[model samples]
Target: MKKLLVLALVVLIAMVSFAKEQILHIYTALDENEWPIYVKAFEQATGIKVQVVRMSSGELLARVEAESKNPQASVWFGGPAIDQIAAKKKGLLAPYRSEAVEKVPAAFKDPDGYWIGIYFGAIAFGSNKEQLKQLGVEAPTSWYDLLKPQFKGRISLAYPYTSGTSYTVLAALVAIMGEDKAFDYWKQLHKQIHHYNTSGSACVTQAGLGEITVGIAFAHDIITKGIDKGYPIVLTFPKEPTGYEIGAMSMIKGAPEPDLAAKFIDWMLSAEAQSLMVKWNRIPINPEAPVAPGAVKMQDVNIVPMDFEYFGAEKDRLIERWKEEIEYGM
Candidate 1:
């Protein structure tokens, strides 16, 4: 009986130790190349185990909504800020204003502190020069150029419903050409689209592989992950103003580990943490943190004026319209 009591005590101690080492779950919209580095750094700094599942921003939001009652993730990281705003409106995010918030620019964060921007990148066309040469097509210089017959069945884009990058493109078009004209533009451009991809970066990858002549994605991704890797792709911004995404992070509402998640948020905003984005060719939200070499400075790009709150509110309506008018008709 005394030996049995010792065994039970040892088992209890083991269980307690296992519970203390419980992993912090993260639902991330960051690319796979970026997340592992972040997870490693975070674990090394905090001594907390992290398990991450990577998905597109829209998919991540859907998962968060589906699991709202019993949240599975402690945080949502590295998605467009507009998605974060939409999540906040749905009460999926917990508001926690970190001390690090003061270090971020006012334009990069939510006014109510539901989410914080960690980085930003601009939308551009990633064209394969060899593919374009083979097709006798010039690199597209404007959004309108994408509608040319030569581009037919050679352009790849992500569906706006499933991709933050594509949503940003839609929002930019509306802001640039007005809503009515933007829809009309998409109808014309639809003819050239070879396929609608689920992942934003996948289109760029296809372009790099020469499977598509042109891909609509973030310029930073095309440059670093595509061209730099000898994929024969070249990045070009539309002569018209382009949209940019302020990639953000937020604490999940009712997260199992809110305190630990908050700590992670604070750490992400630090200069040391933000600088890690350089490894993935992402610009850091903290001004003091240096960007990756070859990153295009925001000032050099003709960025469209984006109203995050307005776009966040209108996303559902716009997506529904796109489905009916563009996707269905296509």
Candidate 2:
């Protein structure tokens, strides 16, 4: 009896060790607060243990680039599609076409199946209502309004290369207005901006605190924090056409567990996963997925005509121009 008990204990310990070893390493740009729902759901559905590593988009991108020789994470999820596009071009991500891709909009997914769109976010303005009201200033409705002298030192925005949010905003402006007009517009708007942020989401909260009268950020982020906390914030779209981001996912090339990573991509693009994103206040790219309340529909918005292929190709050049013209305060 004693020998039998010892053998059973040994087997149980081995099983536990094996389960731990099988955990999937997931690298994401999502912060801890925004990550819980997706991570929890993934674990519950697959019973696959997950080890999550979170970092800024730039940090993760650089890390992935450095570790290209020996990829660590099995999947790279939740970044701007452009980052994934760039990585794919560099041969950093393996080609993957999830079955769920069929449900997503064709424009949103990669043509070569290198990445998939999970959700979308429109570039919008976040304003501190109290500050605006106190200043007796009406909220800016048009892109030109951002250049008004009254708003001088009252706006904050992210830098393009460091954040996808900023890049989307820049891309949208260029797409909506001709290149000359966009560059000129940014030069004017720069006069009003009080600070440049690293994270796109930061501008939303900063605006809430009245640290800046306005912030350029994704509409979802502004609404999620603004309305809930009653931070006296308001979300507004530009009178002119605007730009948006395809919150995207991709499997890293040379992943340690290709099969498991593929499974994750499939599950993420699934109707079930897309629906979960709506619960967290993200706009589901899947037409079949239900939209969240107060969420802006793509059909209703005047999305600046996008050419993602062009955007991807020109990203480096455009970002360099922005750094020199916008970030360095030239």
Candidate 3:
């Protein structure tokens, strides 16, 4: 009787230990539309149980900042690379040298191993094709067209002070045209903007539902939802070139499961991981991943020459300028 009781206790301990090893915590800015695809694939590939926590870009930034005293998440994935860059500046991220990173371009991965780009997305105009035709407005093909009188009160975008997508848009424009011209452009474009939103991805959904004729947001978001939900939205970039985001993954500083976190980062940047991004309609930054059908590949686009390091350095000033000239309507 004593032997049988000890055997049962040992089995229970082993089972608990196995369960603990299978679970990993991940923090992300990706919404419901993007989470399931990753969770399902990550689990299947590595047998690591994923506990995903979703927050807005700003919210996630704040959370990371708040938890700096004692980091809770093991890995941070799927936020704007710029935010991750900013976090690296604050020592909120730990350096991770993943072998899988060799598959990514130098421009896409962090030089010091703080983060690695999983996919690339651009800030583009998402036009409701049916609504534009109904309103007798031609589909906007350029940044200047977004400021036309026809688009007045018919465009949606996020607020730069709070959203990474908007900030990326701001950074891209500044990189493309220089600060003075970029602000001048935004000040003019402000006239056509319906209102600044709190959530960047929300802008895309608003455009799909015809709440606005044009939406400025990440191209992958508009394409993913439109393809999945049958929304008649057309995603297009400007001919003059535009900014793009390198969606990234990073290990949190002092992660509890350091080995597991490093392994997760390695898996995340692999060709297999990049290929899984196709379900989200995202363009992989990895050259090895086959581009999804009907998805806009970055190589085919005229992307603006962006200095991500410069953008990271000047984010505060850029955000302040946006608030003064556009948000407060200076």
Candidate 4:
């Protein structure tokens, strides 16, 4: 009788532990206002609960590295793919290839399945019309136009060290202009910058609020968070060609609930999952997924092909170089 009671207790404890682990934990850099929409839909479909820890691009990388010995999350939900590439280089991500991964194109995913893209958006200039008018300037139609004398100390963007979007802008410049020229251009344009926001989207919101005349940010942010919200912001793109970001997801190395994490990843790539992004103004990477109305697609803007592999590997080196070269608020 004693032996039987002990066996029953062990089984009950195992079941309780299993129940406790049913929740999928994720470290996400997705926009705060948008993650709930994706998470709620995912939970409703999979019937699995989700717990999220939201952080910025650089913060996410640091968190994943700090917890390498004991990972806190099972998956990385969203951010630029460059971040995922950096994590993979550090061996912080687990390889995961599934039939659902076939939906994403090669250019947008890691060949080894370390990461996969869910959506994409381009870098754009967001200007509050009233703010621009107050400064006696029209919205800039090209990247170089931002250096205009009237726009001095009126521009804002996140610091590249902490925000993926700002890094994309940096990488994009290097792609369009050669490395030497790009550095030279930033030397002059840095003077036009009023503040360096830490959050990727905050600069756009700042522009919409008229705190700055222009915010260099992702196109979706300008529309969904700026214009559509009635902020008097108008969106424009660089005529000289800019770069876009692939919003990526990956399974963390040694995830506590890998099965649940895999399920979430598969669903995230599905047509159903991609469909949810349109409302948030992200263009789905899946060809089968519906496009957001007026969303900035790759062909819609003058853009250069960013070499994700090269950029991801060089992020650290380039950021250090940026600090050394560009004076703060020059």
Candidate 5:
């Protein structure tokens, strides 16, 4: 009878361990402030516990690549779709056609089901009005204005090596100007940059605090977090067409919890789930979801033509060149 009891105890322990493994682990590239709300909502809607580690898209990509042989997370949530496309090419993403994919526009998703866009926003400059006024300079109306001697050492931007926002800026410049001219522009702009922050939004935060005169970040993030928060900041787009990002979600290859990951993806894309984007001032990809009141409609903006596939494929080479030519020289 004692031997029988011991075997039963072992079986119970195994069952408990299996149950604990049901928790979903995610590496996210979204703002850290937004993760808790998402986690709480997801856990309440579905019984699955979510564990998230928030980082920049570049950092998430690096971590995912490092852990490819022994995966740690089941999914990557909320990063540029171009980064997702790069991941897909690297064999880091697994193809899963979520039911929610049908609701998403074709341009916002991978043709092969590798990743799906959940939201999108345009890139723009955030200037601290008070700081600009103090310097007796008007707010910049175009990218070239940032290179003026008066703006030198007054701008903040993230390093392209570890920031998706920075990468977007680089790619946009390349699309607006030819590749060679874009590189030349970056070399000149480097002199005006006060610092290269590790996180993309950090620059915006700095500008909001008046630590710097200007910052480069997504217009929506700047408007919501900086301007709406009572900071003396103003959002402006470059006179030339601006670039935008389609924030995406993807399943990691060999995810430990494939079913749970798929569920999370579908839940995020659902109208009810996508509605949460408004809280963060993000534009939802779901057609049925209401957009933020002050958000600029893409149709009204002059958007630069971006070849995501080409950019994704050339990401490494471009980043290396940026480091060698821009960062190194600076």
Candidate 6:
């Protein structure tokens, strides 16, 4: 009788815990002003409340790892897919094949359904017009132009360790300049820094406000957040092939709201949600979605062929090297 009573109490506690988690929880790496737009749409469509914890991809990965034993969130939304790939190898994600993702290109998702790409973007330089004018320099037309003697201590880039956007740039440079040369290039570029940022988009905001002469950022962000917003900022791409990020989403391994999480994923991949991203200038991966009016067409830019498998596998080793050699000095 005592065992039966104890079991009843245990079952009641489980029921309460499950009820508490009916409101879906998510870990997201989407920009601050960006995620709310999607969340609003999701709640309206599904009547499911979402709880979000926002962090850059690197920090999100660390948090997910820490919580692996007692998983907290139901989903992870919006970050460089490479980080998602890293998470998949560690058994941190649940595989769910959604019909909404069926039309997404193979290049943007794992064949086995671990992660799905939402959008993709290229790297570019966001130049502060007033700052550049004062310094007598036109917007840089090439990556090397930022290295000119006049630009020293005037360029901003986020910390690669903390910012997936910055890591995408680092990997792109590696693809463009070879491993050793890429490190050397960054070492040179490092001396031109005006302190690194923790959040990737913060540097672009700094440039838009003329706090710095230039900030290395994604082209879509430069367009929507800096240039189109009427800030005194203009974006320019590298003459050589540069890196791009395939922003991805995934379901958590032990999601409390498994069915709801799966629904959220399908909802996000729906044409409705994908189309909504265009207002922010993100080119959605759903082929059915329209590209933003001023979105940079990949064909027009010399894009590096990203090896997701290699880059995802090598991210930790590369980040460690970057910290030792470029960020903190070897």
Per-candidate clashes come to 0, 0, 0, 0, 0, 0
What is the Cα root-mean-square deviation between model 3 and the actual structure? 2.8
Question: Per-residue lDDT for 287-329 in model 5, tens only?
Answer: 9998888886687577898998888888999999998999886
> What is each predicted model's overall lDDT from 0 to 1?
0.90, 0.81, 0.82, 0.89, 0.89, 0.89
Better of 1 and 2 by lDDT: 1
* Ten-residue region with minimum lDDT total, candidate 6: 292-301
lDDT for model 3 comes to: 0.82
Candidate 4 global lDDT: 0.89
For model 3, how does the per-residue alpha-carbon lDDT over 201-260 read when each residue is reduced to its tens digit? Answer: 888888888898898888788888654668888878888888888888899997877777
Write candidate 2's Cα lDDT for 85-169 as tens digits. 7777677888888777787777889888888888888888889989888888888888888887779999998877777778788
Model 1 collision count: 0
> Clashing residue pairs in candidate 5, if any?
none
Stretches of model 5 off by over 4 angstroms after superposition: 1-17
Better of 1 and 5 by TM-score: 5
Q: List all candidate RMSDs to the true structure.
A: 2.2, 3.1, 2.8, 1.8, 1.8, 3.5
How well does candidate 3 match the true structure in TM-score terms? 0.91
35-123 in candidate 6: lDDT tens per residue? Answer: 99999899999878899999998889888888999999989999899888888888899999999877898899999999999998899
Candidate 1, pairs of clashing residues: none
Q: Which runs in model 6 stand beyond 4 Å of their true positions?
A: 1-21
Better of 2 and 5 by TM-score: 5
